[model samples]
Target: MTPTNILSVEAYFDLICPWCLIGKRHLETALGLLARERPDVTVHVEWRSYPLIPATPPDGIPYRDFYVARLGSPQAVAVRQAQVCHAAREAGLTLALDRIETFPNTLLAHRLVRFVRRQSGAEATAALIDNLFTRYFIRAQNIGDGQVLSDALAECGVDMPGASGTPVRHDLDWLPPLNGPDDLPPRTGLGVPHFVFNGTHSVSGSRPPAALLEAMQRALARAKQIATRTAA
Candidate 1:
């Protein structure tokens, strides 16, 4: 596995997952560090869709109530929110959890991501993903809504389909199915924000930028070693 100048990062995530957003920010920071420290390496990130709450209605359910039920009590939900807020702040993000009113089914959102990725590229798709996160978590907008998704696409400079005027399509043959926790090697528990580096190394959860940077370095080194061995 001779290391090439290009390094690929595959991130499996769900749109509504709070920790995924934080992990994305940390990964961006790590990439910035890599740019400064390893100028020779070009990093590419591919976002994989994983719907965390596939059963939620497209219209969504009361956000607060959903959390209260999931966490077993209102107080528990509040405690979890506080913990998430603190973690988000460390990642330089402000999660407006109170503003959110709905917990939406993310199937449409994931399909929209695949549509954007096909129409444009990874950079544009990433921009749309970021916007989706902001809309859902920060702006409290329902991303599962067709109109909301159309507006988001426009914001990302992507044109909506003429007849439908919405990006939501039932056909997701192009986008690969979400990987089960067992699919990836070296498991670290089932969770979003799973970052697979160079197809050989992986880091789970919202790791700090420093830790992510170290993982990237290790992946790069391993790739180089493999390439060297192959060449010989």
Candidate 2:
């Protein structure tokens, strides 16, 4: 029998990015495909943090206005959203893009996810991530709002007892603790929803399942080769 090789996947993402959610779905699909094809390879995923809009106001700005300004017009925003919606549908996700109201500073939300991972476990962490994204993208709730976050925490069975309950200052200049060699080259010109396998194979953006599956196979193969060389 062939010995199984473990592949470490570090997924750097932020809750505010809808593409990240789509990437999550794609990764899950890729893992399922990988299991059938490469039973000798096992995957271990680590969800890491990457804040997209760290400068957002603590109270958050209007989502529609922000996108309109960034995209240059309401019409442009609609076109961009349509593009996202088309991609979301392909990923088996339904995103009510117009339902979103706030472009939030996601510092607290990211911290809360880290908290869940540390206290509850992987299942709880996934549940909380979905809860936050559902509330924000589907229901269009303000994730920066204390009430929204409080409800999500309760639903996820996370007990963050000592939370200050005060608003996070947007200018706090905080950064999440990063690990491994997942950083993409500057030439890539992309952010969030990045996947790194075996600390070497990395891809950015919302890749299709087949592409992701290919990366996993290549990474695992390289890992086994390195292992064989190290043992020799």
Candidate 1 overall lDDT versus native: 0.83
TM-score of each: 0.88, 0.85
How many clashes show up per model?
Answer: 5, 0
Of candidate 1, the 10-residue stretch with the lowest lDDT total is 180-189
Off by over 4 Å in 1: 163-189
TM-score of 2: 0.85
Score each candidate by Cα lDDT. Answer: 0.83, 0.79
Give per-residue CA lDDT, model 1, range 100-170, as digits (tens): 98889888778778777777989999999999999998898988886788788879987655535654443
Q: Among all windows of ten consecutive residues in candidate 2, which has the lowest summed lDDT? A: 178-187
lDDT of 1 at 176: 50
Query: For model 2, how does the per-residue alpha-carbon lDDT over 134-166 read when each residue is reduced to its tens digit?
Result: 898888888877668878987887765544685
Deviation (Å) of 153 in candidate 2: 1.7
Residue 170 Cα positional deviation in candidate 1, in Å, after optimal superposition = 14
